[model samples]
Target: MRQNNHMLFRINLARRKFLRQGFSLLASAGIIGCGDSATTSATTPVVIPPDTDSNDTPGTLTTTSTPQQVVIIGAGISGLIAGYELQRAGHSVTILEARERVGGRVHTLVSPFTNGQFAEAGASRIPSTHNLTLAYAQHFSLALDPFYPSTNNYFYLQDNSVSLIDAEQHINQPPWPGAVNRSNFYKIRGGMANLPLALSNALAEHINYSSPVELIQQTNDQVTVITGQDQQFIADRVLCTVPLPVLTKISFSPPLSEEKHLASNGGYDYTNSTRLYSQFSQRFWHADNLNGWGDSNWPEEIWQPTWDNGESSGIIQSYLRDVAATELDTMDVEQQIANVHSRWQHVFPELDSYLLTNHIHSWQQEVWTGSAYASPTNLQDSALSAYIGLVEGRIHFAGEHASNFHGWIQGAIASGIRAANEIHNAN
Candidate 1:
């Protein structure tokens, strides 16, 4: 179902300047009322392990106070990285997560698919342009492998007609086509989720599982955070890294300003909506020697192609938009699979026979992360600035949503580090 179903707002700018700058970027500005009219201390809080009652590793050292306490709201990649940076700088940090598991949208469900192999449900691939994540992977001794986009691609049209497609030929063409440098897509050696697991391994002590932040109240002295189970935290600084949709629902001390609300609203619009066109077990088209890329003019459900698993097998993954919208959740799994198959089977008839399993990960169905990354149209500069800006004197924000480079693991890490630095510089 549409996890955390909420409405959002739109940001309007006189012109789209970023696109003119050759980076496909946009910029704008906004203003709103100040909160509580209080001048709070900018010092950061002394952080501790999220759940210390259990035997967890002792977190990193502290620099400022006897224990420089900083409370991070989410335990996803962004939260983890924020803690890591602060700890590395000799500050105490604790991460509180809403879900039972770590890795917000970077979920990887392991199950037998073919000859005892598995596939991914959530965030799968990384691009060469993702420098921050790549650097961290290399630092952690993680192996990387290329995603095979060449082997099996097929195209399906409106009338149920199928055709073999050559992705390389259309690399620099039209209809959202960009240059393919062959090294654009890469995956972790084992699975895409391995990256987050590696990062988590580095910061074991700071994470608190199943602890969702209930309220965030900022005072002149500190920011007080209350958990769902009534656990309270008083820290000098707090990072609000929860997803935009979730953040909008949570209570803030003096209440958020109109611009901040708009930023959060626009952010929710960009982050929560998703589209999953199709999914398949094995590359049936590849067995018949066909590439697996298809094109359709559908509004949300768009393309289909082969997605590889590192262990020498893969499935055909479909791409869509708004799969997490309210209307999509009502459809049964069978109906969803059939809908995908109907769009894909005609392009590669082999899909009709070799289909062993079909699955869909409606990110919007996730309580922690409502959806995948934002679309190009959803990103704007004013929204980005407002979403990323520090609030009051105590409330700071970070996450993939609060990034210039939206929806990538690298962007998430970058935002976390930025938030950490903000805390560090404030103190």
Candidate 2:
């Protein structure tokens, strides 16, 4: 979640200094400002409704199906919230998700070690500006924990040389030129997935998971969704929340409007590709007195070692940048581990003593989602406006990409609310 080179450089440098001092920067300059004051009672935890029971096979396309009150495609945050709001508006809503589970890109991975540690494979943090995400936490009694990225770090260059940087001073300064913008990134207290989990809990009855819509055809009147599993759902109003790249591939009976098509095509360029964060049960970085920041312009060299929930423990978690994507599938487990170890040797000379289990999440490999949410490029404004714009007839599009905030849980929620408002006003 970094942008603009100068900002990134400054933030990373400052982060290194802060971590080396164990968050002492917050005390000196009020950086993060006296820890989070937000807390919620454990007894009133957010409630997620029970799972659904329906299944649809892919081959049976039904044309005779009439329009439902409302239908949403994709159950990611946008889809989830859209359904939630629509149902709240008293319309019969159906959410068709291509994946088997909910939460879209917000994945909170529970570890097998059972030591109370978890890692997020997708969409991990929410900045203080993420109003929607924070609001839900407050409404559901979820606690807010501070995720301080301003700490010590290791830098890897193309020559494979490593440089240790102090986060405190580095963040306030510039790493290269544009690094200052990187300071806003933050992680959620419970987990990145908790926000979506909270929303899903609020809208359990209306969603249908594992239902990928293969075809979206609209006549003069209503839209019909044909699933890969052959089941069908018809609705008067349809909200498409699928990724832009995927949306371009799906066939729309008479074809979408020129603006919608252009938006879908143009939006792909903004998509942010990501390498999943690997989770281990131990905090190896703490043992070696390191802040788990190992970065390189080359993807393979930028393996980062991070701590789990525990501030102390010898088990360190690490994840390589997208560089590993090219060779990930071809390499064996032993080779992959060895490659990661090689990179760590540069940033963390003492890493060998505290290393534990290793896990990797390659978002590109996920069939449900090809990559992370879209990143805003120069083309962002027009493309986002196009995708978020109402079709004027009966179609609406909502998702993380459709949001102005873009690429976080809050964007999804905000877009969902926006789409709901659009539908409500049309009636």
Question: Highest TM-score, which number?
Answer: 1
Error of 2 at 178 (Å): 7.5
What is the clash count for each candidate, in the order shown?
Answer: 25, 43
The digit string of per-residue lDDT tens for model 2 on 339-427 reads: 65676566556556655556666665677666666665666564446444455467787777776556777667666766765665554
Work out how many backbone clashes candidate 2 has. 43
User: Which regions of candidate 1 fall more than 4 Å away from where they truly are?
Assistant: 1-67, 112-116, 152-158, 167-182, 265-268, 271-283, 291-293, 299-314, 323-327, 350-352, 375-384
Candidate 1 differs from the real structure by a C-alpha RMSD in angstroms, to one decimal, of: 13.8
Residue 116's lDDT in candidate 2: 53
Off by over 4 Å in 2: 1-68, 111-114, 149-159, 170-185, 262-267, 270-284, 299-308, 311-335, 350-354, 376-389
Local accuracy by lDDT, each model: 0.57, 0.56
Compared with the true structure, what per-residue lDDT tens digits does model 1 show for residues 1-427? 0100100001011112211321221121111100000111012111111232321111222354434579988877888777876877777777888887677777665553454354455566665555456545554555554443433343547666455456544322333446334435555655667767776776788788888888888878888888888988878888888877667657887887765676656534554443443335544555565545556645333332224332233455555555334455578877777666676656666666556665566677776666666553445554445545555677887777667667678667766766766677675
